[model samples]
Target chain A: MSENQSILVIGADPAGLQASKDIAEFGFRVVLVEKRDELGGAPIRWKYHTLAPDFVPTEKVLGPLIDFVKNNKLVIIYSSSIVDSYEQKDDYFKVRILNLKNKSVSYEKVSAIIIATGFEHFNASLDPRYGYGINPNVIGINELEIMLSNGKIVRHDGKIPKRIGFILCVGSRDKATNQWCCTVCCGISIKQAIEIKKILPDAQIYVIYMDIRTIGLWEKLYWKSMEEYHINYIRGRVGENTGQEKNYWLKEKIRLLEDLLKLCLI
Target chain B: MSENQSILVIGADPAGLQASKDIAEFGFRVVLVEKRDELGGAPIRWKYHTLAPDFVPTEKVLGPLIDFVKNNKLVIIYSSSIVDSYEQKDDYFKVRILNLKNKSVSYEKVSAIIIATGFEHFNASLDPRYGYGINPNVIGINELEIMLSNGKIVRHDGKIPKRIGFILCVGSRDKATNQWCCTVCCGISIKQAIEIKKILPDAQIYVIYMDIRTIGLWEKLYWKSMEEYHINYIRGRVGENTGQEKNYWLKEKIRLLEDLLKLCLI
Candidate 1:
């Protein structure tokens, strides 16, 4: 909370940008570093279009934060830079940042160090069963988002898909990739489903999920998607994804509740 | 539960039709009566374009219920009929239904009676201050819905409104009218806002509310309306409604949260 003291924040994404701004507002200097050339994180840089659950404009939501970070005199932003070295020197953190743009390294002693490195979307190409990279029709959620924002939500043959299928838990919540559930996926998928319906009103959307984790107040979104959007939902993970000439086929595993011991019949 | 017993369902709306069909499926004869000459309720009959929160087609939602009620042998529908009289006879009730289509009265002895008379929209005409009948621009939520469904959401002069405003808690949640929050209004308004945005992407929509009562999952609808749809929400009640040649003016009473005892500054 002093002018002399400063906080070193790594990764100038949404979290990093927001934290630096908040700390600067509290009368502390902040040095925000980003490996990328710009301050906007993967979401903005990659053009994610809209935010999940609400589907508000991504720019509108992040505009104020971006503005605050830019205008704040106490916060210094290091674009195209990475932390070269970091050492704990008693109460202070001695850190060296390498600026890729200038080809020079700078040392800074800060009172506190904060790491706000953002996350990466699971590569759908790793899972061959989904035919992500192989098939032109099959795409990851992040890719679909970028496509939607760019008005490219079409099949490989440049035609609006009559029926679009969203396979939930592509990488997350799987034994092979991530064993944890990406809680935001359900809301994101629901939001995307609504967005798709808005663009292609006649298109039928089906979501195949292990379990919809849009719990609590977010459950309303899932229900709305079902009742209002008329989205079809099947409680099972898709097994095989095959790309034909025009249509993409998804083989779903139908499991019966009564036959708990029996394997799923695809 | 037996074929000999009968259940009387008042009002042949969605609830009545579905209930009668459900009861008839359980081997009980159901007599569904409506004063209006329609099987679908006010919502269906009035043709609300899309159901709130999710924006699903209303016809798709109510189609199955209407189909079941019409096809079921045990479910007898009496359109243009009303409950004339009722009397409890031991365990059964003798009810008289007057047919509006024909000048005749029919009596039925039923084991159980269900009152499924749906709600009505608050008459905006009664509140002269809001200029319901005076101003064509200022309309009730139900009227807006009918207009939206009919593709008549344009101005009275047949021009797209660049700015549209909604005054929440119209009649239901007031001391002068019905003393209960018409909970569906919030979601309905939210849905209407989104629908309007879809049609007129450049149009600015604002909702002036005393308090947004979009509780639980319905809150997601409110958030979507705010964040995704970019609908503006002002936390206050409009006191005056003045319609000019083109623009409709709303006088809002802004209250400070700190001043609990102090009156709202209009």
Candidate 2:
């Protein structure tokens, strides 16, 4: 509770930004650090077109957090920085951060430390059957998100897809992968599918999932997508995406749709 | 599970529509009746602009139900009609519906009945302090929803208000009223508040509440409204609207902002 005591918040994402502001507003100096040159983290910097469940723009979602962090005088932002070392000194942490912006290192003694490095989207390239990096039409959810955020919901050839497909459980909840549900991808797919439908109303959207994890009130979005958008929900993971244009096979005729786009969301 | 058995569904609202469709899909005859000229109860017909928790268009919310009702041959709809009387036989109920369109009563023997009349907004006029009917600047949440749905989010005089205030617990949860918390009101106010903010970004929005009942997953909307939109949350209900052009009482000073609008939601 001492005014001189400080809190070191590593990563200036929503959590870190909020923690820094909340702590700083309570008469404590906060050293908020992030590796990105700008703040707002992945959800703001990248994978935020429309937020899940609500479908409002990411800008509106991150607006207040950004404003609070930017205006708080007590929050000292260390962009393009990382907490390199930590030493526990009795009741406090003596932390050394490599400040890449200044080409220098700085040390801070803080009563508490909050580690908020955020997360990395699963590397879809590791699972090659989907032909992620190999096929021009196949992309990961994060990539699709960035594309959608920038108003680029189309194939690499700059053609609007007549049918878009989402293969859920890309890296998570698999025997070979993390063996746990991502818990977020289902809602993301539902949200993105709705957005895509909004953009291309006649576009046939499909979700290939092991199970739609949208439970409780979040199920509203999934229901809305299925009922209103007429989004097709196939209860299986897509085994492959051949490099051939208009690939067709039995029930896999869904993959043969012209100008097809696929999102491998883990 | 006899195929010949029928179910009588009252009130062609979302619930009735869904019940009728569901029963009909299961190979049962459904007699769906509504006193209203059209389908979709109040939420669709009168109050819903953008639904809570997600904020999508009401048309999208009601679209699938409408589609299901329209396409199902087993689901017979009777608009401008009401369930006039019910007589129980050995097991099934012999129901008489007064067909207002034909000026005659028709009888139907059905196995069961489903009443989906839905809810009515508490008459804000009953709470005279809010000045709902008397004041031009004052309105209820239903009015605001209709306005939002129809792209008419403006004052009675056709001017956009720079400041909007919402008084929660308009009739419910009070000594003089129903004395039960209308759980939907809190989420409704939060959703409307956010929508208002989206429409008029510079508008100073306020929610005067006994308690904001948005809980669990629905809490996300409340958080977004407060954190992102900077909507102010006052802890007490407004005591008066006085029918004054610019009510300048101390607490009523919030209502005195230039181009002010007030919504009372029970």
Q: What is the C-alpha RMSD of each candidate to the true structure, in Å?
A: 28.4, 28.5
Clashes of 1: 2
User: Per-model i-RMS in Å?
Assistant: 13.1, 12.9
Query: Cα miss at A57, model 2 (Å)?
Result: 50
Estimate how well candidate 2 is docked, as a DockQ score.
0.01
User: What local lDDT does model 2 show for residue A154?
Assistant: 81
**lDDT (Cα) of model 1:** 0.73
Model 2 spans with C-alpha error above 4 angstroms: A1-266, B150-152, B243-245, B248-258
Worst 10 residues of 1 chain A by lDDT: A257-266
Per-residue alpha-carbon lDDT of candidate 1 for residues A21-61, written as tens digits (9 for 90 to 100)? 88988688899999988776877876787986677888887
lDDT of each: 0.73, 0.77
Q: What CAPRI class is candidate 2? A: incorrect
Question: What lDDT, from 0 to 1, does candidate 2 have?
Answer: 0.77
